[model samples]
Target: MSTTPVNVQIPSDTEAPIIADFVEHALRVAYFDRQHWASLPSSDWDAPGVYILMTADGSSRVYVGQARKLRGRLQQHNNKEKLPWRRALAVKRDTTAGFNTAEIGYLEGRIAAELNALHQITVIEGQTSGDETLPKHMMISLDAFVKSILGALRLAGLDISRSNPQTLTEDEQPTSAPVPSNKPNKTVTVADLVSSGLLQAGQALFLSQAGKEAEGSVTADGEIIVRGVSYKSPSTAAAKALELQSSNGWMAWKVGSQSGPPLDMLRQQWLIQQTEEAEK
Candidate 1:
């Protein structure tokens, strides 16, 4: 439904009413409100509100949190301001876990009622009693969720917080790092690559060659871009030049990274989970 936007100024007094303009946008998109209350002003629209905004990871940990104004809370998620994991999971297609996102976003009307009835979660005034925080609604911090999902993904050692968001830290990026076992980084392995659901097994590829053209059947015209992805063929001349095996399809696959660890480490993590589940 068409609605007038609420130009809510940051609450000057703690008691000043705060409205959800940004959130209204989200609500509009989510519900496609072209019919009911299409002409209502956000200020006078439904008042009691609650929302569950969360990000899922390969481990499938649901970071459940609530907000007095759900629209405001959801806005916080679209940006990288404080939530770093979005940069990680959103980019590298999570394959290790599954999610039913909005597992609860739609129930805002009822959930808000319940929370209002019980007085749980919060819509606290931040350091600025009046300067409105992001939605004033409570939210699940990225750090908090990472701890939960990382464990579920079983990569107890992987730290998403440490990944650099900057592009091309080095001219020659290495895909396989030295995992004490000389295996590839589990997240970057071919199987893991396959699991990412971003590429088909043996899809067109091209390893980065810097000053030279990419080699083999795959070349500059290849479908995959070397942007942040590893491109070292398991058996490339570059891999062989670096003394890697010719049959090293790992090197030939050349995703977009260079010189990291093996990609199968995450698989081992999943195995541990299966073992745990089997014993149960």
Candidate 2:
């Protein structure tokens, strides 16, 4: 499937009971208090996804869960007052075909882990490591989706993390070619890689590690575009897509498919040919 750009719309006022919609990818997150949640229509949240209930008090307690139908699952929480959760963030895929059981299970486990790592909030829920047996590509897609959810939480004034979830940090930006004092640098672009027949225009590329996944495409001009942003080199593209300080794109991204050979393999082949010609 062709990768689409992610566009998330968040509300300006976090105090208001509102639903911040990620319109393009249909990753919808509704933030509301008890009264606002009770007033929402059940039909709108009938899809499968994960939900988070958090305390507004200074306790910073949270509960993460998954369900087939968010409406029914959340309703159960509303009837029971044991958790003392004052605010809720109900997340659901706003698409015709939404998440499956296994997908939500995977998200539940992943989200729980992310929260635990934050060290700010104490998860009130029991130990839940959901089913993680999913395809590589699917896991990558879900990881990106999870980022969107985290972004929404950040917008709602939750101190989830110190860094912005969506924005690439200054250190994460792609570095320029190194220019030596004696000689001018020969900048290597995706065009150079493709001219060597190592890559094709419009070829799909992906990076996956530690349950995080990112996708990009090789353009006709030899630049790799990730999340609608273009980069001059594969390393920069991989770093930007993966939101890392730096990455060796040639090794980080897989060409053509998720299970395909690492880009470095093709780079090695091209370097070998260059060496052979230089020796002659």
Candidate 3:
């Protein structure tokens, strides 16, 4: 399937309600709090769709289900005191000919399977019946629709990615590059340097370990840019390249020139300067 960007709309800045949709796929995502559930239009309740119930108290537990009547299903959930979820996200097909029970069931099953595979969040699977065969074209569309839903959830700070350990062959494993461990450096973290402004964006940095080296830079968004790839942290980049169980990127990476002092030294220097200025 072709990759396309999903458009997300936030109607109010103060509110958490969000609407994500793909103009071409007719798939729409609606995320709202429990109090705003009644604000949903009557059409959404009448439509056959999939909904995710999430805890409002910042928990990873969620309930996923398909409903022929979205409003009625949520109302039933409201009565269940055991289920402490207070927020909901729903996705539906917007078209003159709405989805049937079979189609919705298939989508619900597929979503449940994907969430289970991710193992990131606790998914409370809903009871859905029927196993209808979808056409090839419809299946492709469904796949795209699922991607949009996941993307929207991620945007909302819900991580639904697979993190399970899977065995791989030698060819499948990433090759480890040699990095140098010349002299043990002080304890300096990426966050420390960033918070102190000692490591600003667009600063050049180098990663050298196990006799291998890679050039990298800092981005405006506080991400590490290495060999044209952007990573959330230096350790992630190093781990991905070395195939190691874990890596401390700050200790392994050097700033500026290859012969320059370790990042920790720079951090220490910054700290000393801050202290001296404060004393003055």
Candidate 4:
């Protein structure tokens, strides 16, 4: 038997946090602020999966559960004003053969147990062990699923695991070029990059997330195009590609290939040139 290692990439702070690590069945876990959840189209929520709801005020309180159809279940949670949940982490398979009842139940049970053991966050529900009678083969297959879910939760800034813990500082966080304004900090626009020869107009841009890929191109002006829509800011274009409210396009997007340098790196080079010229 042979195994291939998969890399887990942390999302930029400016982007909605999602951890889609290597797992069978195309497992993906995405974080959603409560408003983000509410804003999603109805079709987005119509899936069978497990979810963890977290309190809004940074309370570390959370509830883990599974549903056959996430839309109805999440809506019910929304109505319970007393529940005090402010955001959610949803897990689903991107394959045609989605999770069955027992599979999600098993995942929910295992996920809750993992959270409970961590003792870093409070698990609001009692006895989350669901469908424990799965066959041996199924349990073996689900082991990776459990690992990926916990990994996703950890990467999403939850202290749900002890392995490879990470803490990012304010300056260390990734951010796009400041939004265009009449102010002086506007020197780092895509147009500026083009003028400075850091990027050529009509050059291709790439962004890959959770095994999915998107392509955009630098327009002649400062904007970029994705799916025929032109956006004024890279972060906005990245957000559009990811279907999220915001993303640090500087970090989320690559110059040309999946392995290309992020826009932030190019922006830094431009800034360095500016500093040298100022000194001269």
Candidate 5:
């Protein structure tokens, strides 16, 4: 699948952050501060789309819902005497061609289901009217919409990929196992690249020419952390490491086998496998 670049803008220090295509749709993320909400233009509240309420303490606690009138809904949340959350993010469709109420409802359900399946985040699904029957063509658009929202959330520094314990079934739940002795293990396969930590954990990319390497790990937050520095794009990290004005980090970095394809290829394959497993 072709990848499209996302545009993220943090307009002011006090205002909420924004991620969007600029032309068609936009998502605004903000800490649930009353002052911040007050600063928002009237348009944001009047817009129709989905919103997510999450705890500010970095716990898995979250609430996901869609709102036809965002301002009113948020006001109601504010009126609650005791609420667990102090942060919220809202996704708004800017154009008339954007999501309708029914579509947003469907998107809400699908996102909730995916979060549950991924075992990520403690999702408290708010009161949604439920799924709406969408036209077959609209499904494609909805899929794209969901992708954009997920991307925006990631860019906003939210880790939606963290597994949520409440969603796990009894059989799927994790249990403590006896530790293995420090001995020679069985033959390793390609899958071992991840499980064995050669590819995913504490992995480093070597720049043979520069004789310098940067240590990093792929994080559940959908970012690559290199030398204690986190970046949403691999190329950006590579550029920083290489001290070059710009460089494609994926191509510049090599893993276990320096002679093989770049580390990005392996990472991409790993992600594909993860998606397939999640589907099952």
Candidate 6:
């Protein structure tokens, strides 16, 4: 529901057709003019759909679209104070005529399907799951991420969230010295892992988030469950790895038999060896 009322006004005399085309694309993908389409008695309210308006007066134009809670979305457009994307469309030519002009929505596909189908500048008060081609995780807001961070720190038994050692009741503080970092700030050269047989050709590991998924050696030494979700890790002993966005890599990633841990455990051993060697 990140909808903001955007108000970018391109002259109707010049932008009318452009608006129409934009609306047409968005109608197929992002938004719809639900009021006009669903108001009729014949319309099946239960059916998921979309509707939107295209702005044009014989020549130039603009297009505006909305979805999710159709009534609320459209109300924002009419009111010009929702998300900025909606406000941008509301000020086209005559404020009253923007919605009244040629509109399109619910032309084809389910509501989400149609909304995404249009590719229009969408203004909705809810999150739109990007298409099936995309991953499922939503972008968490900073506030939510912070809350999760606090929870994760507590779970890991780390006092990093606290301002000072005295903040704790003292029984919660660990008496042992903190573990030393084995990884040198220096980068591990690409050749290092290759020389150690950590990564094998056609090994099929995503090197990093940015790296392609083709194939790489199993150098990420860690014990990864075979049937459960496989996560990406910053280090061999990392408490948690960034969860893989694509396939359930836990099942997809394999070494010999699917029963034992992922080859990553062996890789993790290699990392531990390197860290110990560096410490010495």
> Top model by TM-score, which number?
2
- Quick one: best lDDT, which candidate? 2
Please, what is the TM-score per model?
0.19, 0.57, 0.54, 0.50, 0.51, 0.20
Worst 10 residues of 1 by lDDT: 86-95
* Candidate 2 TM-score, C-alpha based: 0.57
Which candidate, 1 or 2, has the higher lDDT? Answer: 2
RMSD, model 1, all Cα superposed? 20.6
Give the Å error, residue 235, model 1: 20
TM-score: model 1 vs. ground truth: 0.19
lDDT of 1 by residue, 30-103 (tens): 21111221222344322223322222244322223333433344345444233322211110101223112232
- lDDT value for model 2: 0.69
Off by over 4 Å in 6: 1-179, 184-193, 204-252
Give one digit per residue, the lDDT tens place, for model 4 in 173-262: 234433223223433666667888998776789998755679887765556766544565787777767876556687888998888998
Candidate 3 local lDDT, 1-280, one digit each (tens):
2465678787865354577876767877788888777766775555888888888676687777888888778777777644688778887877777678877776776566556545556767543322447654454446446556666677667777655322222212122321124322233345446666877666777766776777665654445644333455567656554556656665566788677655556545555655565556
Candidate 3: deviation at residue 8, Å?
Answer: 2.9
lDDT per residue as tens, model 2, 63-82: 88999988788888989865
Worst 10 contiguous positions by lDDT, candidate 4: 164-173
Q: List the residue pairs that clash in candidate 3.
A: 178-209, 178-210, 178-211, 178-212, 179-209, 179-210, 179-211, 180-209, 180-210
Q: Write the per-residue lDDT of candidate 6 for residues 61-99, one digit (tens) a residue.
A: 222333433444455455563433221211111222232
CA RMSD for every model? Answer: 20.6, 9.4, 15.0, 18.4, 17.4, 17.7
How high is the CA lDDT of each candidate model? 0.29, 0.69, 0.63, 0.68, 0.54, 0.29
- lDDT for residue 213 in candidate 5, whole number 0-100: 56
